[model samples]
Target: MPRIVLATHNPHKVEEFQAIVAEVRPDLDVVAYDGPEPVEDGVTFAANALIKARAAAAHTGLPALADDSGIAVDVLGGSPGVFSAYWAGHKKDSAANLELLLDQLSDVADPHRTAQFVSVIALVRSDGTEETIEGRWPGRLAVQPAGPGGFGYDPIFVPDGQPADAERTVGEWSAAEKNASSHRSRAFVALAPLLESL
Candidate 1:
C-alpha cells in the first residue's frame, strides 16, 4: 500500500480519512502526522488545507494530505467556517462550539437555518507540487440536537433536499452511510482521479 501522511493528530479524523481512502483507493494507506502543528493562518479552506499539507510533507518527507472543513451556516454568514474548531474558544471543545453557535442562532428561523459542510482537501508532494479540491454538503440546522453518530455540528444539521426517508441528522447515520454521503467523501471522490494520476 502507498502511505500518505495526513496532517492531523485527531484520531477521529485519522479514522475517517482512512475509511474514505479505503473505499476510493484501497491500495493507498493513510497515516497521521506526528510533526509540529503549523499555524493555520489562511483565510480560506483551500489555503488552510495546503498550509497543513505542506507542513506534513516537509516534516515527513512524504506526500501529505490535509483538509480544512467546517460548518458554514447561512444566517451566520458562513461564520465558524475556518474557525469551526475554535468557535467557542481556543480549547477546541466541540460541545462548547455547538452551544455557542446555537445560542447565536437561537432566533434564526427554519428558512434561514441553512448551512453546509465545506471541505477543502489539499495534497502536497515532496517536490512542492500541490493541488486542492472542494466538496460541500448543503443542509439546514435543526431546532434541537439529534443523533449520536458524528462529531461537530452533525446533530443539528439536516441535509438539504433530503428525502423524507432520509430525515436523520448526520449524527444519526451509521459510519459507512455518513462516509458515503459526507462532504469529506465527496472531496475525496473529487481527489481520487488526481491520486490515480499521481
Candidate 2:
C-alpha cells in the first residue's frame, strides 16, 4: 500500500481522514504527520492546505495531504473564514469560538442566519505534483448550541433544506452520520479519484 501523510497534528482530523480514505481507497494508507508545523499564513483555504501539504512532503519525502476548513456565516459576510480557529482570540477554544459566533449572529433573524462549512483538501507529492479540491455544506446556525458529538461550532450548525430527522446539529450526529454528510467527507470524496490516478 502507498503511504500518505496527512499534515495535521489533530488526532481527530487524522482519524476522520483515515476512515474517509479507507472507505474510498483501501489500497492507500493515510497517516498523521509528525513533522514540524508549517505556518498556515495563507488567507485562503486552498493556500493553507497547500502550505501544510508542501511542508509535510518536504519533511517526510512522501505524498502528503492537508486540509483547511471553517464555517463561513452568510450574514457575517464570510467572516471567520480562514480565521475561524482564531475567532475567539487565538487559543483555538472551540466553545468560545462557537459562543462568539452565536453572539455575533444573535440579532440576525432566521432568514439571515445562513452559513456553510467549507473544506479544501490539498495533495502534494514528493516530486511536487500538487492538486487541490474543495467542498461545502450549506446550513443555518441554531439560536443556541446543542448536542455533544462534534467539535468546533458543530453544536449550532444545522443543515438547511434537510428533512426534519436530518436537521440535527453536526454535534448531534454520530461519527458515521457526520462522515456521510460532512464537508471533509465531501472534499475527500472528490480527492479519491485523484489519489487513485496518482
Going through the candidates in the order shown, the clash numbers are 0, 0
Q: What local distance difference test score does each model get?
A: 0.91, 0.91
Instruction: For residue 96, give model 1's deviation from the true position in Å.
Output: 0.6
Task: Assess the local accuracy of residue 69 in candidate 2 as a C-alpha lDDT between 0 and 100.
Answer: 98
Please write out the lDDT profile of model 1 over residues 1-198, one tens digit for every residue: 678999998888889999999999999878889999999999999999999999999999989999999999987889999999999999999999999999999998888899999999999877788999999999998888899888999988898767877687888888898899889999999999878754
State every prediction's TM-score relative to the real structure: 0.96, 0.97
Those runs of model 2 whose alpha carbons end farther than 4 Å from true positions after fitting are none
Model 1 lowest lDDT segment of ten: 159-168
What would the per-residue lDDT of candidate 2 be over residues 1-198, giving only the tens digit for each residue?
A: 789999999898998888888888988878789989989999999999999999999999999999999999988899889999999998998889989998898888987999999999999977789999999999999999989888888899898767976578888889887888899999999988888765
